[model samples]
Structures are given as C-alpha cells and as structure tokens.
Target: MGQSSSARHRRNLTRPSQISSSMMDGSSKGTDLVQEDGVIEGHDYISSIPDDVLSSIFNNLSTSDRKISAVVCKRWLIVEGQGRNRLVLNARQELLPIIPTIFTRFDSVTKLVLRCDRRSVSIDDESLIQISLRCQNLSRLKLRGCRELTDVGLAAFSKNTKYLKKFSTGSCLFGVKGMNAVLENCKYLEELSIKRHHGVLEPVSPDFIASDSLKTICFREIYNGHCFGPLIIGAKNLKRLKILRCMGDWDRIFQTMSTRKDNPIMEIVLERIQLTDAGLESISRYTNLETLHLVKTPECTDMGLISVAENCKKLRKLHIDGWRMNRIGNHDGLVNIANHCSNLQELVLISVNPSSESLEELATKCKTLERLALCGIETMGDIEISCIAEKCVELKKICIKGCPITDKGVEAFAWGCPNLVKIKVKKCRDVSGKVIDKLKARRMNLVVSMDSIQIEPESVVDDGGDGGDGGESEPTASSSSSNGGSGSGSVFNTRFGLLAFTFRRWSIGGGGRSV
Candidate 1:
C-alpha cells in the first residue's frame, strides 16, 4: 500500500505536463489541475507581469520599499534600473553608506530629492561632490534641511549639474557665498528656495542676473544683517520674491528697482521686515502683482496698506499681520481694499480692527473671497462676522485666534455661513463644547478646534487672601520666592527681576518703541 501511494503522489506532480494536449481541449479535469498549480506556484504569479509593468509598480513605492523591491530578484533589479527616473534619496546615516552603490545602478535619474535632517545628519563636501560626479542627468534637485553643505560642495555641484532647472535647498546651512557659487554656475535654474541662513554676505552679484528662465525666488529667514542691494539687483526678472527676516535699507532698494519698467515682479512676501511708506509705495508700482504678504511688519501703517490696495488692482491674495492701525480708522484701509481689489480671494489680517461696514463691503465687493483669517482682533463682534458669513458665500475657511467671541458668535456662524467647512478658534475663551456639538450636527463637514480652553495658563493666588501689600507684591521678592530663594537675598533679588522690570517699564514709557 505504501509503494502504491508514492507512485500516486509522483504521478500527481507530473500529470499537468503529460496532459498539455488534453488541457488544449478545455477539459474540466485539466482546468482543475492548472488551478492547483497556480495556488502552489506563488513566484510564477509575479513572473507573469511584464518588466514595464513591474517598473511602474516600483515607481510608486517609498524609498525604503523601493530599496527592498530592488533586491527581490534579478528581474526586479532590472525593473528598478529601468525606473531610475523616480529616485528620491533622503539622507539617512545608513543610506549614506549605500549612496555610491545606489547611484551606480541609477545612472539616468532625472528628478532627485536629497532630504537630510539638519539637526541630526550632516552631509559633507565629499558626499555632494560624489553626487554631482555620478548623477549627470539630474534636473530637479531638492535638498531639504541639509546643514553641513558649504560653498565648496555647492561650487562642485553647480559646476557639475549644468542641466539643473528646479533647485530648492530649504533650511540649509549654506551661506550667501555658497549660494553665490550656485547661482553663478546653474544658469538654467528656474525655481529656488533658500531658507534660514544667518550669513552676512551677498549671494548674487550684478554678473549673475541674466537668467530669463528663472521664475520663483524665496529668501526666507535669511538674515544678512546688511544691505540687500546686490541680491535685489540680481533678481530683476524674478516673478515671485519672498524676503523674510531680512534687514536693510529697503526704501533705497525699492527706489532703485522701481524705474525698471521692463522687469515686473508678480508676487512679494515681506515678513517681519522694517518697511516704511516709501518702500511700500515703490513696490506698489508693480502692476502685475497677484499675491502679497506683509506679515508682522509692525512699522507699516494703514496708509501704506491703503496705497497697496489702491495701486495693485490685480492682487488675488493678501496676508497682513501686526500692522497697528490706531491712526487710520477701522474702515479706511479695508474700504480701499474692497473698492480696488475686487478679485481678492484669500485675506488674512491679524491684529487689524475692521468695522461691520468694512466687512460688509469686503463680502459684497470681493465675491470670490474663499479663505479668511482674522486673528488677534479683540474688537470684532458677531455682527461683523455675520456680515462676512452672510455676504461672502464662497468663504470656506475662517481662522479666528485670540478673538473675543462667545457661543452666540458660533451660532451666528452656523446660521449665516452654510458653506463653512473649517473654523479654528484658538484662545477664544467663550466658545463652548455645546456650540461645537450643534455646529457638528448642522454641518457634518465642519471641523471645530477647542484648543483655546486646554492651552490656558494656570492662575496664581496670593497667600494673603485679603490682597494686602505683602512682600510678594514686589517683583524681585515674588520671583526670588518662587525660585526657592538663594540665601543671598539682596543681590539675587535686585539683579534678577526688579532691575529688569524697572528698565523695561522705563523703556516703554519713554516712547522708545520705533524702528
């Protein structure tokens, strides 16, 4: 009986090959035999897919998954080589060891994204030089958060990668000198983003300003601490210019470039800059502007904002923050924006008080307004918000932080704005969970955040319940007492808190807060 069973098992294995001619006759027994082979032969299933289809599948995988997929088999390795156009080498310490080998396999890469954690990983000069030597067909290169790249590495890269078009090095440690080397060599570059480098030298000179293909330039958090003349002059044909945390004689820079009628800048972002009315007027002459962001420009007054609204008629999006308009009434600047920029779609105004009438004008005139953010405006009531909600039917997002609004305000929004999808009320004390629940029921798509209540600081109470003038009333004594009092009271008390508070009060009362 055992010999007979062994012969039956061997016959079961070779039965499909023996009856190949019978399978062509469409017999039920042959079909069942092929199905059984398919269930047992898992490798054969993947082998049926063509190389081109496998390459397309590999292109959609993540970097780690792609590395694993490449090692599945010789066929998969070839498929990975065929899909070399989709190579994104994020700089991991482990990945650094295999980069050379990976580059050797992918010799025809077109778009390469090199991402590194600036705080942890350090990309040295040798690595960049190696990359430039190996990847010749590299066109789009994005180096995000790479800190160890200096001028020598950039010079090597720019000298090698001549076909580069879209280059973005965001939050890198490259100084202006390194960037100067890159701009000088990469003449075919189109889009550039250089963020958060506190260097003192200029990046581009007069000799490197002749690129007709360049479209976007972002200088975010680049504090050169000197004049921006050379940088601005080099970006004469830039359509988008973003200057964040830069200090210089902006008025002179704007005046010098205002007369260039042949060159027109389309978008400008001046965040936390010291800009005056003259600088704003000079920038307003660019009639082709589509987007403008003046965030945290405390020195800019309502007159400057009014001038921008009146002049830049083609403006589509406007974001302004920390512009104290106590001199100009609530409706003046907003009225100008409503009357002139009728095509406005996105508006963000923080700490700027606008009346209900101005909100009505904005809602009625700017019918295309979609996203609105009014943060830190303590005076805006439910009536003004309701006016915006009722008139601006296209409004999709409303972010109100540090605003004095209650459940009544939430009710007004629920009733007036039927199309509202998102509402963020951070630091809004009066917004209750009940109101949020009501809105969630009415508008199922609505998203509400109650982060205000959870983020409040704990209030302290005095030991003397009668609120008498205790020793804790003194700023020095209060801080020293809270710090568990270093035994030498006089020096520690006077040096730490009392003197600092006194100096701060004196400086504020002496009218010394100016640019």
Candidate 2:
C-alpha cells in the first residue's frame, strides 16, 4: 500500500509536464490541480495578496520599479498609485494633459522633480499650479528648464507646497520677485538653490527672507547677488554656503557675510567668483569652520590663507586652486596652515606652488593627513614628491594632474607611504607607462589610475583647466566620473568636455547640492 501511494505522488507531480505535448498540439484541454475529493484549485499567484500588504510592498519601490510592480494585476495598479510618494515626471508639453491624472494617482508624493528637455516644450504656469495643488504634501521640489513659469504660477505653487523643505530651480525665466515669492510662500523651507534667476527691476523685498530657516544655500551664475545681501546676512544658523560664478563685487559681499558674530559656518566653497585677500580675511571669525575650498579665485594671495589657518584650527580639509594666476606661492600660508590646522586630513593644491618646505611641514605636523592631491604646480617635482612619500604615513589616496613629476617622483610611492592604496595621474607630460608599471609591480595591491588628457599646462604652474573639481560642497562637480568624463576637455583638447562637465556640475539647482 505504501509503494502504491508513493507511485501516485510521483505521477501527480509528473502529470503537468506530461500534458505539455498535447497543449503544444493545440489541444482544448485545460490543466488544473485536483485533489482526491475531485475539487479543482486554480493558482491564484501574487494576486491573492491583500491590497494593504501589496501597498506596503509597493511603497518601498522606486517610481519606475513600481510601474512594473503595478502590472501584476488590476488591484496592484491601484495599490501602487496610492502608495507612491516620490516621482520624477517628464514635463514635455504633450504630457501636460495627463499630468493631472498622474498626480491624482500618486497623490501622496512628497518629493518631486519636473524635468523638461531643452528642445522640448515644457509645462507652463497652469500645469505647474495644477501639479502643486494636487501634490500639496510635497517636501522637496525641483524644476529644471521650465521657463514659462512666471511670478503668478510660482506664488500659487509655493502656497500649495507649504511643507516644502528643499527647493531647487535652474534656467527658469524669472526675476528676483518670482524667486522671493517662493521664499515668501514656502515658510517651511530649509534648503534653497537658484541658478540664472534674474530680471530687470527686481522689486527689493527683504521682509520675507527665508534665511532664518535655511541651512544651505547655493547660487551659481547669478548676475545680481547684491540684491540678496540682506537675505544672506539674516541667516543666523547657516551651515554650508557655496557661491560660484556669481558676477559682482563678491569680495565685499563675502567679507561682510563672514563678519557675522557667533558664526556656526563650517564648510565654505568659493569658486570662479571675484574673491580677493580682503574678502577671505573675515573667514577667520568662523572658529568652527572645518572645510574650506578656494577655487579659481586668482586675487586671493598668501594673506588670505594665513588668516584662515590662524583661526580655523578645527579645519579637516583644505582645497586651493590658484587658477591661471601664480601669486599664491612663496609665502608662509601653507606653513602656517601646517602649524595651526593640526587636524587637517585632506589637502588639494592646484597651481598653488608649494615648496619643499611647506609640503614637508604638512607631512610632519599634519599626522592625520590621509589624502593629498597636487596638480600643475611647477614647483612640485621629484624632491617634493619624495618628501610626501617619506612622511605622510597616513596617506591613502594621492591624485596628481599636470604636475612636472617624472619617473622618479611617480615611482617613489612604491617604497614609501606604507598605507597608500590608490594613485591617480592626469595630464602630466613626464609620467610614463613604464614607470607606472614598475611602481605597480612593487605595490601589488595598490590602485594606480592614469588618464591621457595631456593638455599642456600654461603659466609654469597652471593645472591646464579647472576640470570642475569643487571638492567639498560641490559634490556633483567633484565626482570621479565628472573628472574622467568632462570639464578638462577631451584628449584632443576641445572645450566640449569642460562645457559638458560645467552644465552638470555648476548648474545651480543640481550643483552645490550638499544641504
């Protein structure tokens, strides 16, 4: 009896596969599992799950992934629509008609991005207002290339997103009034970023300044920064501040802003703005300052660096780019930094000629220094390279770009820097494949990265080009992918790479996004 039952169990399992030939031959027969009592049981699959349970599962999926999840069945579609709380919608004109329905389905969305192609027609005022009216729970909103939105729509939309915490807009055709309108309406905002937002006769209004609640603010390519001086000055709790390519007397603006007493500012990134030593001197008041990045500010000399080092003793990272100017060298700025900023960990110097004396001081006093980058400095050669290799015991990653280092300098790390694990070399004329191979042979586990974007360095100390390296607050530009792909131009030396990286990294809304 036991053997017969076992044979029956085996037969039941093999019956489904056995009937496949008949089904392939266009048989009308149906397949169903039948119990001994002759009752048929259909495979309910995932559809049997309760709607609430399915909604919970759908909530964890991304907008695109949830679309796939919704296709499981009719009930799943409703659950996914109700559970989705984050969305990115393409704002092409043709899709404008369906946006209301889409927002209705994803009514719970709190974070949203409406992006439009440059050549495509973007949604206008009505569409934006309608979207804001529906997604009223929105906490974060980003609009890119939606040029038709005027003050009327911006005001209406801001009213709806009362809970909005983060707002980012770029390339929008709006003046200071429209920008301020959002700040006035969205009282709950904590982060704000604006790009290319300017128009004539910007109605000056400071009563609705959002600085009190703001922790981070980034302005890129803005022409009229002076108008917003009162807004910046009012930020008592501002932590991270980044300003790049904003044309004006930033020297006076920054100096005034930095003079605020009881300053809690920790990280400050100034790039491509007209900054001078006079402007940077006020940063000394930020005793809590931890990270400082001065990029392409040609006017800032040794005096600015010394002032920061003397006061900001808690500094953990320092990145300086002298750009096309070479006035930052032959001073005690780096030496003073080494003496006072004992906790410094990461340092990147570009076109700022660091003598053996300064590098030696950093290697010796800054025992905590882990990552070091030196690019396009004429003074950086075998001697300076050897000094770093001999000291800097905690050094882990080193990046060299367009420096005058040769085989001896490149190969020195093979025997030095016991904790070193990765090395990056770019645009250097003297570093050879043979030397790199020999160095790699010695350090079997080390990651040695080299790129052949060999653009010749100009002024004996130039790093060729900016290459969009905005280290601290400007994360999008400082990425490895950005460095590898663009802003440094191409291997053939066109400005296309720089343009591409510039748009990606410096676009105010998406750039300096370290809030």
Candidate 3:
C-alpha cells in the first residue's frame, strides 16, 4: 500500500514538469503558473512568488534541491534553469538528439561537464561543436570518458569557446595536439588538468609554448608527463602546480625550472613520482613557496629539507610521506625547517622518522603551528609528544597514529596546550582509559577520539618500483589498495586514515585553502 501511494505521489509531482516550450513562451515572466491569485492548479502556494524571488531562493539552495524545485511548475522550472550556472550532462550518443533543447533550457550555464560512462558510446566531434556553440559563456569545462573526442574536435570547440578559463579532462583519447589547441585558442585559459591521456608520452617539449596567462596546471596519471616540460617552463605566470603519478624524468624538469628567473610558483604537490634530492634542490629555488606536499617520495634526503627550509622561509604548510624511509630527514636537516621556516602553521609527517631533538626544535621555533599529525614514527615516544604538549601552545588539532608513546606521554596533555581541543589516537596499545579520562577531566573542553580508524580503498598506495620516464606505449590498469584486519597489517591499515587526514589539512594553505 505504501509503495503504491509513493508511486502515485511521484506521478502527481511529475505532472507539473510536463509543461511544453510553447506554454513557457506564452506564460508571463513574473506571473503565477495556473492562476493569477498565486494558486497553482493542484500544487502549493509557495511557487506563486515572483520569478526574481524564486531565483533568489534557488540560488541559495543546493544543486540537488534546485533540481527538485525545477520540477514544481513551469515558472519554477524556468527560474531554476536561469539561476543554474553549472551543469553536467551525460555525454552519450543518445544525448546528441536533444542537445539544442537541453542548451536552450539551461542557457545560462557557465561551468559544463560532458561525462559518459565507459561502456557507452561517447559524444563525438559534432556533438562537441554543437555544445561549443550553445555554451559560449562556459568558463570551466570538464570532459570525462569522452573517448570519441579528437584534436580536430577539440580545436573546433576551442575556436568557438574563447571564454574558457579552466579545462579538465580524464579517460579521454585527446593527446598533446588537442591539449595544445586549448592553449592556443582559449586566450584566457588559466588552469588545465589532464588524466590518463594516452598519447602525451612522445617527447614534444621543445615545440610547446604555454600561454603566459596560465596560473595553475594539474596532471594525474599522465605517464611521460615530462614531455610537457616546455609547457611548464613557458607558463611564466604560473603560480600553483600539482602533478601526481605522472611518471617521467620530473627530477630533470625540476632542475630546469629552478634555472628560470621569472619563477612564481607558490604552491605545489608532487606525489608518487621518481622525485629525488635534485628536484628538492631545484624546488628550494622557489623562494616564495607557501605550501608543499611531497607524498611517497623515497629519494629525498635531509639536504632537500634543509635547502627548502633555508630558501622557502615563507612556507606555511608542509607535508611529507616517507613511507618508512628514514632517509627523508634527521635531527640536523629537519631542524632547519623550524629554525628557518618560522612561519610554518601546519606540519604532517607520515612514515617519517624524525628525532626528538627536531620535534622539540619544531615546537619551539614554529610557535604559530596549530595543527600537527605524526604517524608511523617508530621512535616518536614520550619525549617527542612531550615537546608538542609543552611548547605547541597554539596547537588545536593533533593526530598520533602507530606511535610507541605510552600513558606517561599521553598524560602530558592534561596540563599542556590549553588551546588544544581535539585529539585522535590510533594503534597505541599502551593508552588506557584511566589516563584518557584524567586528561579529559583536566581539560574539560577537550575531546579525545580512540576510534579504530580503517583505511579507505582510494587512499592506499602500493610500494611500486621507482617511476621511469613516460614511454611511447600507453599504461595498463592496476589496483593499488588493500585491506587490514587484527594482525601485523592492522598497524599500517589504521594509519591510512591519518595519511588522508593530514594531506587534506595541509592542503588548506594559511587557512585560505588551496587545491
């Protein structure tokens, strides 16, 4: 009986959405839907509001709720569509038949996504050209799994959509030629992100000249991404860059970037690559860097850390995942971070072995530090945690995972960091509820979480061999995540949460936040 009533309710709600284009044209822009007295034929009186008022309300609503409002009445549908500035359409071949109609209804869209499932036939060049004509005002375009798109289609669309400022595509077949088309025709393009692009590995760096207007570029899983070295070097005004799992001779490229005099990079994320101390040495040349995330890097050493500390004193957020590699930094090299980069606000060390002396130094010098996460540090015992509790007075959020700290170190929190409010503890077997309660009792406002955090599937990284330069052939698929239970692997599993947690926290540069 309830299912029947639910089906009937849906039918009644959808009846109002059957309005045709002729009816929409004939209806007064500000008038009520069914009656001039602000009463619908069978719907509520709420939508009787003026078009501007309805649009204002829709603007404040979330995208899902606005979609619901669009189905209420013809006037509401028109107002909601007008207020909708971002739209994502399924880029299947079937959608081509109604491209004109869809664009006509949502004519004001400024950010558009053409996404198709891998199993379906994607929209081709003709559809892209048609979309380009309809969405001339689009500032951001994301193409996902659109395998039918090619350089010719991209160039054609690029010629028509000069207003585009941000372009992101993934699982698409378009290569460097299509990528260059956007750079050439889209004069205002400032950001470009490409993932899994099959044909970008062949070396073409010498011919590429990126637009000076570009500010940010991100590449993910684009093997041999170093072929775009000229593009990166040519982007004179580029400020932020993120390239992850894009195997290539990035170390050499980093060396090349350091030689430029107009370098303006302020934030960068380099992950799962063949990064080495040479790249870090080159990165140290970015004197204005404020945020840096070097994840899963094994070749970097204390010299790189010292170089960055000595040069990029303006850095506010720093994160490094050493993956149990003790070579990343030690007492002398890591101490430079605290001694020179005094403005640091947030620090995250994963699978990194830092000495107690560096911890004390960091707490003493980086007084402005507010958030800290130390995970998989085998030697981070009472001394290190004590240093954090005693000196990091401004600290608010802290996460300690898979450390050997005992109840004595845990007890230090009872009187330390008056500003501390939240703490997350995981895989610490020595922590007892009695001491936890004592700390909570001492700091009445503090919240302690001892949850057995589990690893997320997407957050796991397999120990892969050192990355190599992108070859001419395309890459194959591989799964990189694993599960953990009550055993030896549990330690690594529970610590995975902190890996994602700290990465997210450090991504927020100066609290203003960066992507």
Candidate 4:
C-alpha cells in the first residue's frame, strides 16, 4: 500500500513476464477467450461513408437488391427512402403497418404502383389520402385491385396532387363519381387508363367543364363504358382512345363526337366491343386519324372501310382482326382502305384472307408501307407472301404467324424484299431448320432466325406474331456483347448496369455525388 514510484514501475514491468504461456503463445485452442453472445464484430464502414456516395452505390443495385440494402442499417434505409423516385408497394395488408414510415422516407417518389390484395382488406380512402399527401410530385400512379378506394379518396388525390399527368386504376370499385373527381381536378392530366372498374354502368351525363389537356383515354373490361359521350365531348384535344370489352351504344357516342367541329381524335382502338358498321361510319368523320385498331368487331364490313376511306386520308397505321378467309379476300374492306389510305405504313391483319388482287393493290398503292403482319390466316399461302415481297418496295419487317407457306413462298419473300431487315415467323409447319439456318447464314448482316427451334413440319402455335417492335426475343449471353447493327430493326440488349449508372448519374447530378 505504501509502495514508492520505482516499486510500482518495477511491478508493471514484471506483469508481461508473469503472463500465462497458453494465452501468450496460443498453444491451447480451448484457452482462447470467446464471445458467447453470437454477435458480429465489425466497423460500420458503409454507414460511415457520405450519404451521396452511399446513394450512388445503392442505385447500381436492382429494385430487390435495394430493398435488401435498406435493412442493412438505419443510414442505408434513410438513403434508400430519400433517393427513391419509382416505388412499387404490393401486399397492402402486410405493408400497412410500415406504410407511414415508407411515405416519410420516399418523399422524392414520382412514380408509384399500389396493388392491393382483394382477398384481404383493400386499400381504403385513408391509404390513398396518405399517398396523395406524401407524394405530391407523383406524375404516374397505378391503383390495382383496390376495391375499397372511393370517390372521396380520388377527390383528395386531385385536390392535393395537381401534378398528376398519367393515372391508371384496375379492378377497383369506384364509379363515375371517382372518374369525375379526377377529370375535374387534374388540370394537367394527359392520359387515363381504367380497367375492370365499376360504377360507370349507366350513361354519365356531361357537366359544364371540359378537360382541355386530355390526350389519351383507355377503358378495358369496364361494363357499360360505351356510353362515354360526356367524357369524349369534354376532352376536345383527345387524340388516342382505346376501348376493350365494354358494353353500351359506342356507335351513338362516335356519331355524337363526329358532330363536334373541333374533334382531333387521331388513334382509336376498339377490341371485343359491339361496334358495328354504323359506329365505323361515325369514325370516318375524323379525317386526321392516323392509327386505328379494330379487333373482334364482326359488325364492321366493306361499307365501314368505304366510309372511313372517304375522310381518313391521314391514316398511317391500321390493324384489323376477326376476318374469315372467305369474307376478307372477297373484294371486302381491305380493297377500300388499300385504295384510299395511300400513306399507310404499318398493317396488321388477324384471321384475314386478303385477296391476291387486294394484296397486289396494297403493294402498289401503299408504296410507303414498311411493316406488315399476317396472323392466324391459315389460307395465306406462297402467292400472297411473294406478292407482298415484290410489291412493298420499302417493306422493312414482316411477321408471319399461323400461315401454311412452304419453301417457295419464304425464299421468294426473302429474295424480293431487299429492304427487309428482320423476319419473324411462327407456326409455319413447312419451314425446315435447314431453311432457317441458310437464311441466317445468308443474311448475317440482318436478323434472320426462327424462335422455338424445330426441324419437323408439324409445330405448335406459340402465339400470334407481335407485329410491332418485330417480336422481341429473349437476349442470349453471346448476343449481349454485340451492338444493334446499322439496320433499323436489329434488336440488341443494352447493358443494364451501364444504363442504371447513367440514369443514377443524370438524376443525382454532379453536386449530389460530392455529398
């Protein structure tokens, strides 16, 4: 107790000499000190990094990976929330508890997809209000299977988020009141897509205010949506409209809209609807129409196209389905459109039997035609393909599906269409593997190959040819390195990592990186 400074120093110096041999030399494995708490010991190096750098790192990861990164630490969670622009929230019942936290973190979100599980408690008005309040800058919003949402929530959204440009709601229970709320409030609304929604079962009478900013409107699987006269009248600048699987007097609506002198409707798509020749006649008034798609509208005949051809001179893209081989090729609607619509560039025909004369006329008259798709036309033989190849001088891409064309037709088509860059064919039983390989070898500069490899004559039909974008095929590991060639239709995969990095850099800007 009374030791002097020298004695204390001497004791400290002798302490190392008195250490246990097992601990000092590490001779006995059991003698080593071990932590029993099962905790990992590591410095928080990732969290220590600046927020901007961490955000940059997270942006490189996929959406799923970003989610995993968020739970790594509190700092990562904050970064993920603040930097997020696009968010997809599914399984509402499970996420309901942490939704408020998510909203608080992702204040910068612009595009949000909210899907509610219908079997559980649907996302209600409260949830919609919370989202509208949190994401004020939201430009695009998709609400799917949200049966509990109502007009009140939509009203709140319109009142709070005026910047909404595009909105899509599917499998919802909202009706005309909800639609009115959005149309009335969203001043800058450009596009609206509604599917499997109820409440517009009857005619929605027009109000005084008209939406001048609306450009496109789509209705799918909506019951009695055909009586959308008031909405059509309100959207004076409406260009593109798509209606599918809805019942009501669409003919009357088209006739009503035709009366308006300021109508600028350009693109119209009707599928699985009760549109007849009378409705088709009404569509003819919009001479400025460029793209028209009619599917499963059996009531439309030669007379309908004749009426449309008289006025719609600016037509460029045309798609028609539900044509029987005997009905279509027999001096039917194709002749009228081919004769009238000279500027037509892209044509997609499903279950159509286009006459040889009509085909010849199309090849000659529609000199500007570039893309042609023939689907489900079993009768389309070598003659039609040969004629199209020879006549359509600027034909770039041809998608043939469910046709019974043999070597003669295919070879003729390949040889005739000099400007052809890509050819996608499916369910042609007669085409052999050798033929496909030869075509690929000859046109190495072009994209020439068959999807779903088969050397036999009999093959199963996978799907109708996707005319637009030349039937996108899955990318291969070998094809990933090559760039899209000089040809217009040669599809190539861009490295996702580089694309993400570029987008991150552009979105965050140079200043954010320094943080």
- Using TM-score, give the best candidate's number: 3
Estimate every model's Cα lDDT from 0 to 1: 0.67, 0.72, 0.77, 0.70
Superior candidate under lDDT, 2 versus 3: 3
Residue 85, candidate 1: Cα error in Å is 4.6
Off by over 4 Å in 4: 1-57, 71-74, 91-96, 323-330, 454-515
- Which wins on lDDT, candidate 3 or candidate 4? 3
Task: State the lDDT of candidate 3 residue by residue for 171-276, as single tens digits.
Answer: 9987778888899899899888878877665665466788878998888898778888888888888999998888878888888889888579998988888888
Model 2 steric clash pairs: 487-497, 487-498
lDDT for 284 (candidate 2): 73
How many clashes in candidate 3? 1
Expressed as tens digits, the lDDT of each residue in 173-275 for candidate 2 is: 8666677777777777778777766552453465655646788778778777556666676677888888878776776666777767778888887878877
Off by over 4 Å in 1: 1-32, 36-43, 62-64, 81-99, 111-126, 143-153, 170-178, 198-203, 225-228, 323-330, 440-449, 452-515
Clashing pairs in 1: none
The TM-scores of all predictions, comma-separated, are 0.74, 0.79, 0.82, 0.76
- Leading candidate by lDDT: 3
Q: lDDT of model 2 at residue 304?
A: 84
Q: State which candidate, 3 or 4, has the greater TM-score.
A: 3
- Candidate 2 residue-wise lDDT at 70: 86
Q: Give the TM-score of candidate 3.
A: 0.82
Residue 124's C-alpha lDDT in candidate 2?
88
What does candidate 1's lDDT look like per residue over 152-243, in tens digits? 78888889998887777666766666777767777887777666655436534555563566777766665663344565666667787777
